[model samples]
Target: MTAATVLVVALGEVRSPVLESVTLARTLGTPVLLSLQPLSEADTDALGRAGVARALVADLGEARHAPAVAGRAVATAAEATGATVVLLPTSFVAKEAAAHAAFLLDAGLLVDVATLRLESGELVGGKRVFAGTWETECAVTSPVAVATVRANAIVAADAPEAVTTAVEPLSVDATLPRGLVLDEHEEHPRAEGRPALAEAAVVVAGGRGTEGDFAAVEELADALGAAIGTTRDCVDEGWQPHDAQIGQTGVTIAPRLYIGAGISGAPHHHGGMQASGTIVAVNVDPDAPLVQIADLAVIGDLQEILPAAAQAIREHRES
Candidate 1:
């Protein structure tokens, strides 16, 4: 029997989740093929250390920013590599691309996958559903499987020894869809040195309890080298941008460590972060829903607690 091949698709700057996908692919005992844009020397070296057997580089140009175009490239690479399973890092663009690839490949598509394994020669993904209250396992019955994986789902580890990754150019149809045209795009400005919220292993979030001032939250996040997130209420209040909101209507994250301040732990918000490996909640309301589910709960005013916590962390590191 021919060995199964797994394709990991990553776009733009390589992130931790992308490395995790590569690690998972290696764990599958399959020939791992990486489909991505042209890489720099650093990225190429990094992938080699991560155990990529081969890389398929597609020059999508401006179309690289478009999910539909990237999806086409992913599909093309999968076909060329004879990949039976495709893994993608969970992001807005990746989710869209997964849909497009699944449609083109006639594969079973799974999103927000937190665990993946091969069961009886079939790819099975474990994910949470119904606002993070239910866990289910889905096995792909189709010839091919495509899944978008959440960050921190798997720990990234280096290969036993670095191997030279053969690089091959992949051709993709860069034509835009009808009525779509390339336009100027602007990347959202993030705090210097802070990780992206969606992919960060540690996240510190604020809510309306901060009363529109995120100073405490920011300090703590900075001290911990963590990403900053906010509740929907904070976004509506203009305390933070929409991209920072974490809720059912906003971004879903499953970081290793999540610290929430002044959050009520509403079902909508909990649903988004319930998958976090560890949850710490700081709020004045002892009865807050978030406090109930938190692995560690502190009943106090965040304005006072956050700064103190940040200071203690900084002092410990310095000491």
Candidate 2:
């Protein structure tokens, strides 16, 4: 119950879980900062403003993310601070690094933790089990516990006092994993500039009824500062990327708000976003399955309703 320090892996810009992780650390102990190798000044400032007690900028030089190298960087920071707990955002990069860090430090790793608390000096975590239908509690007995927290799952309140954070540089000397050199990269343009689907607080999803056109969906999503999603049919028709598909066979998301447009609310698709806090369905069919579960159901032509809704929201926000 008496953790000396909690090391938090900073997600840098677009950090969805920073406040949540900071709050979690505050409940258990103090938070120390660590970023991916070759840390940026913006990320350092972000950590300092969030009231981190101290930061360890890992200088990995050229071998930035050579699997074990990332783990070694984090492990070194944890050891230096004598950290009892390590909290990281449930992001793709952080999750990958956490897996390796757990092995290197021999810590108990908990992934997708939605809730955690410190009771009698014991860290108890709650996570989803059996396809997000059931909740399971987990507790670690190891000296160092590593937990990856889901985004937007915790409430972050502002601290009462202004904290003066200190930054310390810790250079890590790690050998790259053999045969894991970086290959050439190819960057392609995306349809819209929106947040990652899983991490977004709001999501606007379309289905087969979109008719190969996602203008309305994208517009509404962008207006609400939300992410875009699609059904399996839309992806199959090449209207959206496979990463945007939300169904039983695709990615699962639990945002604060979910808007389903031109969707029938199939069982498979519902399984993906059933955990959403609020659902708003816009469909032509009055009896669409999505309408049954939605908090607000709009029965109309999506082509007309979507644009009008987006415009109204834009105007309201501007006003």
Candidate 3:
């Protein structure tokens, strides 16, 4: 069947991809949002502001992992709503759930999709391949399509008005695979009170030149309301967590603005963020490879450069 309703599966807060997916759905049909957990008041308000048609939640209920439970919940919601297309944010958790949902529905699945649309009653997507060296278009021929969309690939637009949300509980079979049991689990100490790296409009990243200090980079990121990232070298040196690393081995990002400080722009690193709308490189070496790809380059010491930039932004915002 042609896609007539879109089911957006979200883990926590409504990500930029959800908004974009809704926007695309509006062009084709109706859009409804489904969450794994109950939406907070703030999250509900944000969704209303973004103008989603309906909102529903399904508790994971004592689960080994979020994806396994959440995926079945999504399938149940889709069946209840008659949604023919399911859109998930491309986070690790969401991707896992999307994969599970595809298997359950026997639907075609796509990941890291940069664009989506309906052509001749089929869902078509465009994605980056070959380490960002090529773009490929693919279409889903199955009755239902499930896809995980990249964050920040599309601009979000406000809707005319907020719709009254309808909430429902979904039933999911939670039999664990291989009877896996949690022996022990501890959450990592992630950065707090800051924008999430994947959804941030701006990002300030440090590299080996940081020399085990991130004070300057953090200050700059705070000034710009940006997220912080670091190179793999910094992660290996225990200066930053592995989650903060940006490269082929780490998370891929496509922000409106990306600023690199003391980075040499290795291929692995550049391949992850080369799709950024704007790139700025700051390094003492004018011959750095990062400078060649940057829209703007500042040759100077990071100690002097970062502080000055933060102060300038502060003064500009105040004025």
lDDT per residue (tens digit) for residues 207-252 in model 3: 9998988999999998998999988889999999988889889978
| Candidate 1 lDDT over residue span 61-122, tens digit each | 77887888888888988899899889999998899989998999998999989888888777
Q: Output the worst ten-in-a-row residue range by lDDT, candidate 2.
A: 182-191
Q: Which stretches of candidate 3 lie above 4 Å from their native place?
A: 15-17, 62-64, 183-186
**Residue 37, model 3, lDDT:** 71
Winner by lDDT between candidate 2 and candidate 1 = 1
Question: Which pairs of residues collide in model 2?
Answer: 1-121
For candidate 1, which ten residues in a row score worst on lDDT?
27-36
Alpha carbon lDDT at 98, candidate 3:
89
Model 3 lDDT, residue 48, Cα: 74
- The regions of model 2 sitting more than 4 angstroms off are 11-14, 38-41, 61-67, 184-193
**Which candidate has the top score in lDDT?**
1
Q: Per-residue error at 136 for model 3, in Å?
A: 1.7
Candidate with the greatest TM-score versus the true structure: 1
What TM-score does each of the candidates earn?
0.95, 0.88, 0.93
Task: Tell me the whole-model lDDT of each prediction, alpha carbons only.
Answer: 0.87, 0.80, 0.82
| Residues 43-138, model 2: lDDT tens digits | 555555567757777766555545467777888888889998888878666787788888878988898898887766677899886656788999
Residue pairs in collision within model 3: none
